[model samples]
Target chain A: MIRRLLLQHQRLWLLTIAVLGALFGLLLLLGALQLYFDFRSVLTGRSDLSQAQYIVVNKEVSTMNTFLGQKGFSTTEIAELKAVKGIRDVGALTGCRFDVNVTMGGGAIEGVPGMYSDFFFEAAPEAFLDVQSDRWRWQEGDSVVPLIVPKDFLRLYNFVYAPSQGLPQVTEEMLMLVPFNIVIKSKNGNVLYKGRLAGFSERINSILAPKNFVDWSNENYGPAVTAANEVKFLPSRIILQCDDASSPELAEFMSEKGYQTNSENLKNSRLSSLLRVIMNVCVGIGGLIIVLALLIFLLYTQLLISRSSYELQTLIRIGYNPKMLTARYMRYYGLIYLGILIVVVAVLWIGKSLFAGFMDEKGFPVPDGVSMPVVLLGVGFMVLFLVVNFFTVWLGLRKLAMPR
Target chain B: MQLNFRNVLPIPLADTPLPPGSLWKSDTSFESQARCLVQAPSGTGKTTIISLLYGLRADYEGQLLFDNQDTRMFSVDQWTEIRKQKLAIVFQDLRLFPQLTALENIQLKNELTKTLNEGRIREMAEQLGIAHKLEAPCGKLSLGQQQRIAIIRALAQPFELILLDEPFSHLDEANIRKAAELIMQSCTANGAGLLLTSLGGNTHFDFTQHLTI
Candidate 1:
């Protein structure tokens, strides 16, 4: 019998309900997907974010040999830098150049000059987990690990060559160049022995190898160093990853220990803040849409009340007094509100599944830890707000029930 | 219509209006008993009396009785249950649900009463000459048709007594006769007591009882 009454007024309910469900579902799905991707990137070190800031390293090049003497950052200095309060890790960075002599075929092939710098392998584990955890998949027998570069690097250099003709594709292998050299030394001249190339990166021109290997090789080679322009030494670029990024403890610690440290926390903070703003906008818009949807729902329900006033009056005439009227109408309100909530949840689930497919197409793998809880929380909030709003409207209409 | 008032109590009417002497002992034994249609005059407390009968007017000194029990012993909840199970009423204006179809308007009352009587609804519609407009919106129906639909809805409920206030206001002379006949037939079939208020000048149905104030 109730079904017949609803059917009598189906059009309005259908339109209002469909709109409510869609807004709630889309909000849930987008929030879940973004949270999932964020966690994945944080864990995998694939988030295109720079962890540190840079400072000027004065290189007094009285001669080319003196230029080599001012080798970026030594491994020993980096270790001491890590112990500082705000200094999380330190690394050496340099520019790239062509090798003066390396031939692959009959053609006069040039050897790729690699940027030899100190990399703090242990201090910043997340930065290398992508290669370290999955080393076996790409490792090959070589003293140095080959370079892995992104597809974009192809634009910087020509990788085209005919293997049969004995011409190499690209000589700028970031990984392989360092693996060929083994022993690495600290700034105080302590040395660490290393093995052959553990692996080659999938990315082109992007070569990442163990830190000890590169430092040792550069220390031994005098009057010459590759990637001179991109050198980073005792500077503010090191982020300690501690509670406070900007603290006097870090600056004093690095300065007193003969290790130069610059305060790049401000720059890093600015960048992080920018990223946080974008994230907040995405999530907040989802919440805002839900609020707007609830507003529309309230309006629709009010219209429903006006349209059904006569029916309510009829109920009154059918021996239903104020109390009975409240009970009967509340039951109806509860059912319709619950139905809308259920539909919203189901739609959110389906939309998340569809969005998962889209994310897969984009090749970013999101973990369950990030997706499930966010989805549940989003759906829960929507349902909660909707119920509160529904009860408020129902209560208002209850006041209109006349005594019999 | 403009109603004139005379001897209608200024404050409120309680069981016998303070007996015109002592302000105490107002029907002390009959607490739960409420009077309906005891008197009718254009403005001589007719609306107030109806309001009191429906329990809408609370400021009254009276011993209303239910089953020989005093009304004071019963709670508001008890009164509501009595209203739902034993009493029903139609308003002065034909408050037909505008969004509902003619059939739905009737079924709403039945459903609320927990009595799903679909067959009776269809039968009543056909007899009222509104069978063709059973599926039409109440807003689109003629005022006379809406009046019949309201009457049908009031009669379909499972109540001991049904009240009507200006029930046939929208009906023409012929339609009014038709509505009166149908209401009389349904009331007798259900054995439900009817208390209808209207101008006796135009109506032709003879009543078993009438008390003009």
Candidate 2:
């Protein structure tokens, strides 16, 4: 009978049914993707490295370093600490304080700590890497030109706060005028050789220059610059690479090594909390809509079944048992549900390209295998709809069959 | 048709059909207490008397008996079961299942009642001139064809009492005779008692008795 019904309605386009199926399939895919990404986060221990980090201040340059000296991790010790389990890594480099005077258009423009030399070779294990991946990568042909600055630099230097509507290009010339290169005097009041600005870093808090430049400066201007300027010469925070450092034990190990360790767990917990809130809200909305859809399906099926009262009564009169009648109608709706499911799956497959662009725009990471979950959800929903519809139909038919 | 048993009363009903009903009684004894053939107009009380005997209706002013057992021995649900299992009805409207083929309709009745007498059903269908229509859905058949199908469906089940209401109404004179003979033949074959409500003029075979109201 269902086959006959489908045959009769074969002229109707299957596109609408397929579209509904595809929508459900996409939602199913989204749910599976959420689970997959969550598992990846768990496996990779991304949660451990997102919290606060502690750095030891240099005693010579910073008055606060006196206190940090009692708590600092030595350069060599910090390297060893990196190999410890759960210790992600430590970053160490050097920084110099200078008054930067930008000489764009051959005019002086000034900012404090303007021309600090930073070790571009320093490795940022986690936190810095996250920020670095977004900025620019250095290449051979490209002169160390474009700068990627921290958001705080705009406030620190009183730069224009105009929102960039499009991507901004960075060039090498901007680095030349950062420090007002009047005279290079060390803490000892000795004169160092005058140096030219190579390039400015993205930000003033830290600077990035090739190591070769730093080696040249260290070799060319030694004690004179050091004596003229009373600046600290301490290795920056040490960075290290370990086998599996994204573990909680790394924090404990760092503390044991006479260094203050900041665990990333706090940051991870915060992120997880935010993620949970968002997930709950989204799932709650989706669940409510699905329930409503199921209810509507059941009600519609009941109405359809009840309209065929005479047909039911005739069956009863002819002595077709109640169970057999129920089975007959159940089979009919089951076929309808199967058809709906098949159409839904097909639509989702054809619409993947459309969703691809949408997901890319939304910054959602797409995975390779998605169809299994989508098909499972479609089939599950179809069965649920069929069972609910069957019961509703049976109830209506039973009322009609009740001896009156 | 005849008031042979005791405690019986005769009423001359003028061409009225009997509807299902009751008989009255006093405290010390029963007034209408015996078996009797009753004839009435279509609207008078023929159905009422037959229904009372079949225990399809129980409200009454007098007591009823089954083999000297009080009618109170049965409840209304039990009465329905009696109609289902022991008593068969041939409705004036025939009540043929519209969705079922004639064979399925007969087969379903036999299966539900667990009285599978396939040979008899086929024989009766052939005798009623409806053997060819057995596989056809009942609704597509002519009225006379439906009448025979209904009769065959009912007769296939073994019932002690068969209450037929206008079993011959749709039949022509030829089938009228054929249906009456078949009904009587099937009843006799099963050793079942039969009660038929019919128009007075149509029956050609002589009955054990007759009564006209």
Candidate 3:
């Protein structure tokens, strides 16, 4: 009965406009949140292959450096790069100072004919390697050295080199079974050890051996360090583990130092940052719309109370409790807010499902539903709005219902 | 509850010369269930006294007390409780919701108090001869009819005191007699006190006391 009396003077059009505005605002907020969640999951889920968080950086080789034979980084330069913002950890890519030769076939392998090749090998810290294998460890007495070849190198061999040379393509399983001899030759002495394929790396491009193995080999077989030949052992490439590969600070520091890395990785970082900025802007606009909608709703409630002020006063004069009247208005507006939030959540869920379905068709599977945080956020927004508007209504009615 | 007026002079009448028998600026007490007739000429604060006692106005010089408790000290909730269960009034201008039908106006009070059932309310309306007009909006009714609705609304609530300020100004003598009989019966049934104000003429109901305000 109190609701009926108070609602008598309510302008329907104003209520309709307020409800529509609130719906539009909340839907935009929840929709943007849902999209952000989906994009984040997709990015992180495929981060190993596509989003290279570990970037291998090297000083750009120049004619001046070539003439001076000063391509490797100095200790001071490596420390400075380690101190760069956003770089979490830095490890050098150590190159072999000794000669490496791989000899396959002639009883070394079961079926292949005799083949030999000179190969350059590099090793990095285990933390920076994308591939993990128990066989990657090398002890001093172990004669079999495990090697991780780049995935791109195998692709090039199978797709281009082998096809052109009319050679049979080898699968990774087949290659892993092949054990060949690695003959290391240096001025100190010569050593022959068996080598086996450990794994293929998607992140690092270099043919990788274990850091322990490289350190041992360099200490035992390499020449004594001289002023002119010292650069041969210095690290020319460094792998960086960064917190955000897309941080502009990392790119800026790299560019300022005349360093080079995979441009695609930086481009992917820029894309991620761009998505973050767009999401923030969308959320800002959504928040602004919600605030404006709440203001409109408050104004509408005030107008309704003011127009019905006489009736409310009369009711109070006849002994109607002000708190009871305030509760009535709260229940009315609370239900409206709840309905609006439920509709917004439903629409966002359906929209996300449709988008997920579309992405699935494109071979990119996104999660199918509104994320839990967004739903909780929506509920929080509804409660906040209800508290604000209900307080306004309570204040207005209490003032009007006061004795003159 | 007893109403105690101690040298109470409404702010508007602070400078006015008081008649010899006037209750203004005088220590007076009306105990519980004491039916008093407050007769005065026009512009003599008859409505103001009713307003002060009903807590509609606090702009007075002296203290007005309900059972020795200062009325000025009452909070809004306290006043609401007093109005809901202790005191009821028929305002000089019938303060009915114009948009509501006469029965709804009466039921608005009845719903809150729950003192009188619908049958009793309709019976009271029939006795006051406004039964047929109960379905009509109070705004569309005659002043006499609205006055009768206001009276029924006041009697529908439980109260220790019921104030009527010029309640029958628009009613004919015949309707006024019927309203007075109904008012007397409702007061007798509830064992309530009556504070009826008039502009000095023939007044109905034998009162326990009369005061010139």
DockQ of each: 0.22, 0.07, 0.46
Q: Per-residue lDDT tens digits of candidate 1, residues A1-404?
A: 44343234435655566466545645554554555345435433343333432332222334773655454455565676566555444443432221211112132224533434443221112343234433322222334333333344443344443355454465434433333233333344444333333343332123444444334344443224456544432322232344334334544454455444333543244444555566667666766776666666666666665665655544543445555444555566556555655665566556657765676678855432234455566557656755764575456545454333
Which of the predicted structures, 1 or 3, would earn the higher TM-score when compared with the native? 3
Which 10 successive residues of model 2 chain A have the least lDDT summed? A2-11
Docking quality category of candidate 1 according to DockQ thresholds: incorrect
Q: Give the whole-model CA lDDT for all candidates, comma-separated.
A: 0.50, 0.51, 0.85
Model 2 ranges with Cα > 4 A deviation: A1-289, A338-387, B1-87, B97-122, B132-137, B198-213
Runs in model 3 lying further than 4 Å from the true structure: A28-244, A247-265, A272-288, B6-9, B18-27, B209-212
List interface RMSDs for the candidates, in order.
Answer: 4.3, 6.2, 1.7
Better of 2 and 3 by TM-score: 3
Query: In model 3, what lDDT does residue A391 have?
Result: 87
Candidate 2 DockQ, CA atoms: 0.07
Worst 10 residues of 1 chain A by lDDT: A96-105
lDDT of 1 by residue, B69-185 (tens): 544455455656656666566666666667668887776667656554677677877777788898998889887788888888767655566666777777778777777787767
Scored by lDDT, the top model is 3
Each candidate: chain B TM-score = 0.71, 0.74, 0.97
Write candidate 2's Cα lDDT for A1-404 as tens digits: 32232123222234334335434643544453444344334534432334423332221235665565422345566557656654455565543333222223233343222243422322222333323322244333333333333335444433333234332333334433343322333344533223334433331234343333343434444443454343344454554443333334553455454443233433344444555566666566655555666765665555555555555554454444445667776776676667766655565554554554566577653443334654676677767777776778667766654433
Higher-DockQ candidate of 2 and 3: 3
lDDT of 1: 0.50
